[model samples]
Target: MTDNPLSQAEYDAVTDAAAHWCMRLHANDCTVEERLAFEQWHDAHPLHAFEYEYEYEAMLEIWDVAGDLPRPETVAPMVRAKPATPWRTFGIAAAVCAMALPLAAYSGWNLGWLPDSYQHFEANDNVRQVTLSDGSQVELNLGSELTFSNYKDQRRITLKKGEAFFSVSHDTRHPFIVKAAEGRIRVTGTKFNVWMYEDQVRVNLIEGSVLVSSNDAVAGDGLRLEPAMQASYRRGDFTPRISQTYDNDNSLAWRSGKLVLDDLALTDALPLINRYLSKPVMVADNSTGSIRIGGIYNIKELNNLVASLPKVLPVYLTRNKDGNPVLNSIPQQAPKS
Candidate 1:
């Protein structure tokens, strides 16, 4: 035990730094250099190192109790310590499954976010985890625009762009509905993630279930998803269908700030990247529509996504006047020795 006991000043400093890093990471605009800067800041001080380790252990302890952020588990403390507990853990269960009576404690803030400053985004980009008044939790992905309507009868969200994982509070009358790009997804129970673009939509179900349908089209043709399931819809397509199944881990892992793309195309990739950025990444030619790129990237940064190609294909990535990223292919040079 390096130091099981921590003073208030030390504890505040640690959680503050940890919270900044937490918020910075959620902003997801951090460059490699920026990430390195944080690492240096964390390691520079002995107190910082100890607090980070302890806070991490505290984070893991919290996760161990809750399983995840969206669907937090109830974790009541077995014992109280001299210092105040900084974490709150909750309990959640899968949809349509019998749940055991949880020996769970319900305390601490789920994520150490200021209530007054909780929902606002500052500097660079922000991914906010918002807990609605009704009790449903939403982790708004980077560069995401989330507006919640807390009405006496209904709760609604309009995701302008980017992605979000919703652990909807089970309110039958409220019926949480998300409106995005000519489609609407309604859920009563369980947890799911929805990724939206100008022309396409993707939904992945981790635990529980959800009903996905096109608001622009017939609801009858909409698809339903269970745990480990995914669905996608593109404009001009005939119907929506269940296309893939990702293990809950792979499906909901982005909550930890990773991008999960499954053999998506450059054309498809463009809008996804643009969702997290202010400036659009325009692909000059539509002929390259089928050029494919895959793998989970930290939607937090654009560098990894730009690294998808090399050799033979000429690709250019640069920041423009408006500070948006533009990606297009350059004419390949003739082979030279």
Candidate 2:
């Protein structure tokens, strides 16, 4: 056996190869020929044998941690004595522990034992419905974006922007969580409408109860909404402002291809209205945006609303340099001189 030290790349390659062989030999479907091949490879080089022993010990430790092990009778015989090098053992242990975490995490993720990262979904200028793996249905409004992940203990969803209606399936063991802006809504099974404005989130519960809270982990530090109740909160708020009675139909009218506005500021209304339009409309100044408006307008017929804006409110529609419509407040008439 050569006493020369291995370069970093060479050592990594040998360790990786040894780990691969160790996993292959431990597999239930390992064949006689494969075992012979591993034996031959283990004896081919001193480094190979050393790395194999280290990886085998590492695999055993991993299996112990994972609570899965091959039968004692079926265990393969060790091909060589473990080296008594203290530094080498320490290095191997550290590397094995580091490797074990990611390996175990990947396996757990595949087996549905761990939470998955976000899987993004978006509806740009059109409404769409998505069914999750847990059989929950989400109806995304126009210009909306959402992300979701199903963990073993809980199913989580984040409303990144715009609005969505959730029809969650019943699963008492796994609580359903919806996060929007600074708030979190937790439920077991429920149908609800969640609207995410620029800096606020509105949740209107149609059926089932939901606990809306801030990011804090304090127990009972939130508001619980019964069916037909609505709650809203701005970013950074500790608790949502509850509305015991709300216009549920108006809140969900966007789902039926309509935009319902009731004394809502033009600033707030433009964002909802622009979701249906190919070209977005912008206000010239705050005065145009501050105008209070109310209407039930067909989303498909947005042009009608643009034409009627001047007649209903003190605003005029004009085109910007980019050809997008801009709403400007009409100048008040001067008194007779």
Candidate 3:
């Protein structure tokens, strides 16, 4: 009975319809009329029935690989005597549960219910822009990922990795909170940039005020921040370094596809540059790595900078056995008296 194969467009249409039917059945107040309508729609065409079955089976396969997917508390009982409710509805529900598992295992944040409960946003290799449920806007930098979990008490975000710029919506009743490995940031409403990686977390405020606190500290006792200010926390440190000033444009330069560094150390800057390149750039010695350099770099065109670094600094590039480039320091010349 499942002989007919559907085209991609036809399959998508059928699956979409099946999904809607699944939601209606799962709705708490699903009426008998809706159930009857669904029965009619399913019986209207053989292709419809087949597509629904295909979707259901696919969902089961996903469930096999992805554990503990969420589902509605209850679904309305099937009204028709013969050919009960399509398993497609169950599969779609299960697929929704498994949607976030593929990346969760590796990302270090795995609460099985997050895929169903939280809103997820990610930018892979290139910058991405998204609007939050509360009308707030977010720009995710390359390779960054974050999830939003909003509740009646507060709006919380778990920044998994990389950096993100948030233009928060004003909601005094429910304050906004961002939690990273480094610490937690609390604000009523604000515009800010957060970079989280390894054991380091940096929060740069462009506008609005935020309270920065250690992961274990109470929000009331966190450090209060103002515009153009930055707070950085290192792992194992008792407190975060706050009240530092930063150039707003420099902090947010990634939005314009540039890496603008103001005399940042080569060692420190390579990490940022490595985020954009397919291969990593490394220094051979402390001297080469410690050289302070400042320039606006085109992240997309890194080859030019890597080729020209030797001329400006007392450093030279050499390839390893694997042909990966490494920067080594040149002999220090005698200083002029």
Question: What CA RMSD would you report for each candidate?
Answer: 16.0, 15.1, 11.1
Tens digit per residue, CA lDDT, model 1, 1-337 = 3546777886676767864553353333558887888789877766665554444434333333332233223343233232323231111111101122222352222222111111222212656777766688888776666655443444556666667888887878757767666666777766888887676878888777777775556646267777777877775555556866734335455567776667777786667666665556665566555567667777677654554544423566665677655556677689998
For candidate 2, lDDT tens digit of each residue in 228-255?
Answer: 8889888888678988755645888888
- How many clashes in each candidate? 11, 0, 0
Span of 10 residues, lowest total lDDT, candidate 3: 107-116
By TM-score, rank the candidates, best first.
Answer: 3, 2, 1
Top candidate (TM-score): 3
What C-alpha lDDT values do all the predictions have? 0.58, 0.75, 0.72
**Cα lDDT for residue 39, model 2?**
87
Best by lDDT: 2
Q: lDDT tens string, model 3, 1-337?
A: 3677768998778768876665566555679999999899899887567655555444443333233444344423323222323344334544454342355443212333322224667898688999877778899988798877565566778788889999999999978889878478898889999987667788899889998886654435478889988888876556679867745448678898888877889988887776665566789988888998889987567667888989988888998887767999989789999
Instruction: Give model 1's TM-score versus the native structure.
Output: 0.52
State the displacement of the C-alpha of residue 10, model 2, in Å, after optimal TM-score superposition: 27
